[model samples]
Target: MNAPRTPLLEMRGIDKAFGGVPALRQSRLCVGRGEVHALIGQNGAGKSTLIKILTGAYARDAGTIVFDGKGVDFKVPIAAQRAGLSTIYQELNLVPQRSVAENIFLGREPTRFGLIDWRHVEVESARILAGFGMSVDVSRPLRSCNTATQQMTAIARAVSMRAKLVIMDEPTSSLDETEVSTLFGVIRKLKADGVSVVFVSHRLDELYAVCDRITVMRDGQTVAEREMAGFPKLDLVAAMLGKELSVLQGTRRAGPDASMPEVLGVQHLRSGTRVKDASVTVRRGEIVGLGGLLGSGRTELARAVFGADAVDAGQIRIKGKLVKLDEPADAIARGVAFLSEDRKTEGIIADLSIRENLCLVLSPRLARLGIVDNRKQHEITEEFIRKLGIRCAGPDQPIRELSGGNQQKVLLARWLAAGIDLLLLDEPTRGIDVGAKAEILELIRGLADSQGLSVLIIASELEELVAASDRVAVLRDGHTVAELTGDDINESAVMAAMANGTANAAAPAQAGIQEVAHG
Candidate 1:
């Protein structure tokens, strides 16, 4: 037999830690030349950490990396890019204010007589985009185009760099089905051109459609590696969740009780372009989840309900009475609270102390004679800090100093302190550790069960929604297409609704639960 083929990229015995908290432990990955590989895991499973190390964003405490049969170390992101490696993050990193051609050729514009060659830059950028079947004006600002076009532009920049290895993180999160197909075609072309790609996404079908192999990570370790062909989807989910297949195949939570009072009623809700028509109801002591792809109006509906977005036409009922929600203050006064998806920007006041952030919503009610009651604020903060099990130095600690999970808990406490009757959570458990996710889910369930609070949760993770929700509403093209309940809430059923606008009745049971695909 001939000597074993050397991998184009090999990472072995990698170890990383943050403030004595280990993020990766002996994680190993090997990618063959020109192959499309997938890296998958839960929110805090060391996936981002590992990618950061590879791209030189973070220094690994210990590891060995071999690229193209040569031992190499990248000291910075630019150094990695110089070494023929490129990365496209989940969030588009291009400058929106810059022109498409300028963004593509940024920092490397051709110079003539020590001056930039604008004509060459525009021509080159247009040529590159055209190669990807994009025909937008190269001189226009990147933000002028739609999200799909911007995404393709980002990819075009990476491809223009002549990179041998490209890494994509949640690249399709903002793309529609047609745009996703276009992106896949580009990936196939990249593979054909002998460029290796490392794909990361939560969507399973996208992986099976494009990737040749997959590596699963759990709890900071590489759990399994297998070829994409014949690999079971349920097995992949179970591995990421760190649970057995049998456990996942067990019974789901029961549906909502009809006898409970309606806590919120939204009819014909329309907001902006994303939410054209949405109708939903949440009974007291029930968790209703909103499920759909990106731009499916899930977040828009939540914002409209919370009065953050202007409703063009709709009727909202709170406690069986018609209510006008013209602003967030209106919603809050009516015992409604909203936890925005972007916690860092929308949820928390990073510079403020935990006590301050928690008491922000309650400050109006807690004030006396225009002078805030500091003593009362402290008491409320201390109670929630203890009740939520938030790990922090003290109530006076800066919110920015805590971990993602702890910061999220602090945001939740902000709403809970107001004693709201209804909670609107958008991507509540996102960007946090798995342990923290379980704790937050449990806490939400406990509040609904004991305090009789109704929750409307919007999550991109179908399995998470199915597990935590009593009923799931699937939205497509700004419409509530289906509502899954009872035995119909499962990954397959949700995926079917999302993909075909209806669930397939004949899909086999991969994890014991049977699913139906209709509204």
Candidate 2:
């Protein structure tokens, strides 16, 4: 007789709502021992809501949760943690100012004679980190180390707590290639030790490379579940997009018009530790791409151009006129808009309605007699909601309640409505699913083509940038090392530029070059 299979964690018919609005509807997932399972969906697709419910950050209205073969319901995060579940969010929730040992052993520290034992804490912390092949000084402040080291520390803390299931949300977003490999090695070690893991990320390549199984979510429900070997990356993308695989392959188009005039110019720019000697130009009716590995200065370059970061030395000209954008307001005044990389902390106003979020940037222009015009605001919000196909119940819906992709569209609409001359986008499609990503890319292309808009896009996915950009600017250690276009574009060339800042050959970027229709 075949051995009976048993799930270590199983959640069935999970239902959750916020203020009478349904966030998750009948969502279901299962995890087995020693397997790395990935949960994926677009923002607002209920991935976070579902995880929060599982971790006891939010109580589910209806559902069944069985962990380690017993029915369970947790009232708080601590309760869930105590039951052998641990979650590491995208944002490092660790205390940066505190020592590594302190952050690792937070809340529950070793006690001797009713007082915390500092020496035991450090000793245990060092031993835990060492298991992950790390030997850093545990006494140092967590902020002193880079993101990779911080990530390792977080993982060590989770494992130290005897967690049975470790849920890592976008754990590799800020990690470099080497760091990612190291993390994968640690994951393998955990798997060997019989600890299950739930990996969540927008990077599909990483998912296929590491996860043993995949679960796709859409509109707050689990749509498909398949073993890793049985699924293709493109197929998984189609499932997340809620579209047939054949349709996605059929719709392929290049970027903006080549004949448009230059709208924004950057020359020899430098900002702080990162962002060095970089130069880029964006033409009206074109989408220029900034491509590089993590920490290669993609976000830094965007920040410098948008004046979010102070540029030590550089020249910026808008429409052939010099402008000193020392602050974000100055950049906006110059008709420049920036969509930040991190959406939670940098983009949305959690408490505002969809209308307010959409009109936040264009308030002054939409105002009259020192009074806000509600009708005009409604019209603007409705137009964008229809135009971008944002799936919200109404314009009055809370901005925080909308899905990630819809929120991004609202941000894009904010800039588009402001009559801006230049748009700076940083990882604009970071956490969104396949379908939304395609729609956003198409929207960008159409805007640049039909509206004569100028856009600078920073994206980590090589294929995405190559597919949608007029030119790819490769950065290495805060400097612009290479810019590839017609006859100099491909994965090999981009990677070559990224690793060494120079390559022997470059392939022509024929696909992204704008078509010319001469009379």
What root-mean-square deviation over C-alphas does model 2 reach? 9.5
Q: How many pairs of residues collide in each model?
A: 0, 8
Clashes of 1: 0
Query: lDDT per prediction?
Result: 0.83, 0.81
- Residues 1-519 of candidate 2 have per-residue lDDT tens digits of 111156788898999988998889999889988888889985567899989999988999998999999999988999999989999998989999999999999988989999899999999999988999989999999999989889998898888899999999988766766788888889989989888999997655566668888888988999888886656544554566464522221222455557767788888887875666788988887788897655567888888878889988889888888878788999988889999988878899989999999999888887889889999999999999998888999989999998888899999998889989899999889888998888888888888877888889987666677777878788765678798875466555665565445632233212111111000
Error of 1 at 116 (Å): 4.5
Candidate 1 deviation (Cα RMSD): 6.1
Model 1: how far residue 206 lies from native, Å: 2.1
TM-score of each: 0.73, 0.63
What are the runs in model 1 whose C-alpha is more than 4 Å off? 1-6, 96-98, 111-119, 141-143, 248-257, 266-280, 287-304, 308-317, 320-327, 339-359, 373-419, 424-451, 456-519
Report the C-alpha lDDT of model 1 over 253-299, residue by residue, as the tens digit: 56457899999998888788677778999999999989876556889
Name the top lDDT candidate: 1
